[model samples]
Target: MTEDFINYYRENISKKSQIIKGVNDFLVWGKSQKINFAICTNKMESLAKNFLKKLILLSFLIILQVLIPLNIENQIQDI
Candidate 1:
């Protein structure tokens, strides 16, 4: 699994066109194979969405290195 992930990253860096093509292929394969996907992170949904938006805006930015500032007070809500 680690090797497969590393290969994916290497392929992504080595050629963008290839990376996109491979991603599309993988998606197709996953769908055909009835694979269920889920992303689990410690980050809240709002923060994750905001970070994704920033990443789209600046493709050059290293996503892993980008820090999303969260307002803890606002994040907490009373029901």
Candidate 2:
């Protein structure tokens, strides 16, 4: 279930996640070019923000988009 995966992500996956090679350079290049970057994810807003923050990439993004249905949002909120 969603809750199980979320729990697992929090406990095991988040800390181990790695930034892709060149992402920082790419973001830097994009910034120099006056391009804006955003993260569009199925993850909850807080989770997505935390993940990005953990990777030190949160500052590169101007927007964080969490695309989840109302029911899933409610379920995540409840948990």
Candidate 3:
């Protein structure tokens, strides 16, 4: 059931996703300032990464975190 929802969202809803205003510019500025960013989402990691990639903001992140096998502590340590 969860997989089905994820697949449906990926195909039907994700295509309509939009980047918020000034987000790209902010990311560019943040990168230049040496501020690493991380994304924490309930969404699947792959899906979240794909979403960020589509917005051209993936490169600005130091890590992407989802509730997976790895705990949040481990995820943060990886940064």
Candidate 4:
């Protein structure tokens, strides 16, 4: 299910995803303040990284070095 969603999102990311206005400046400011960004989402790590790469922001992510695991269900299920 997650893979399906991520594949679909990746196909549409070009149209659906975009770098927010002032994001570059904000990131620079954050860097100046010694702050790092951690992107937290249910989205796949690869998809998130690809999107950032498309926006030329992947380098910043390397500095942050926080790629949370891609798939770890948090719900309690019947065993």
RMSD of each: 13.9, 2.3, 6.2, 6.1
Best by lDDT: 2
Q: Candidate 1 on 3-52: residue-level lDDT in tens?
A: 46544544443243233446546655775777654444444344444444
Positional deviation of 27 in candidate 1, in angstroms? 1.8
Off by over 4 Å in 3: 68-79
Where does model 2 exceed 4 Å of error? 1-8
Question: Tens digits of per-residue lDDT for model 2 on 1-79?
Answer: 8889887776564665787899889999998898889889987777787778888889888888889999888767934
Report how far residue 6 has shifted in candidate 3, in Å.
2.2
Q: Tell me each candidate's TM-score.
A: 0.32, 0.78, 0.71, 0.57
**Who is ahead in lDDT, 1 or 3?**
3
The C-alpha lDDT values of all candidates are: 0.42, 0.81, 0.73, 0.63
Instruction: Sort the predicted structures by TM-score, highest score first.
Output: 2, 3, 4, 1
Q: Highest TM-score, which number?
A: 2
* Model 4 lDDT at residue 52: 77
Instruction: Tell me how far the alpha carbon of residue 8 in candidate 2 is from the true structure, in angstroms, after superposition.
Output: 4.3
Clashing residue pairs in candidate 4 (N, C-alpha, C atoms within 3 angstroms)? none
Candidate 4 — worst ten consecutive residues by lDDT sum? Answer: 70-79
Query: On TM-score, who's better, 1 or 3?
Result: 3
Segments of candidate 4 deviating more than 4 angstroms: 1-8, 62-79
Instruction: Return model 3's CA RMSD, one decimal.
Output: 6.2
User: Which pairs of residues collide in candidate 2?
Assistant: none
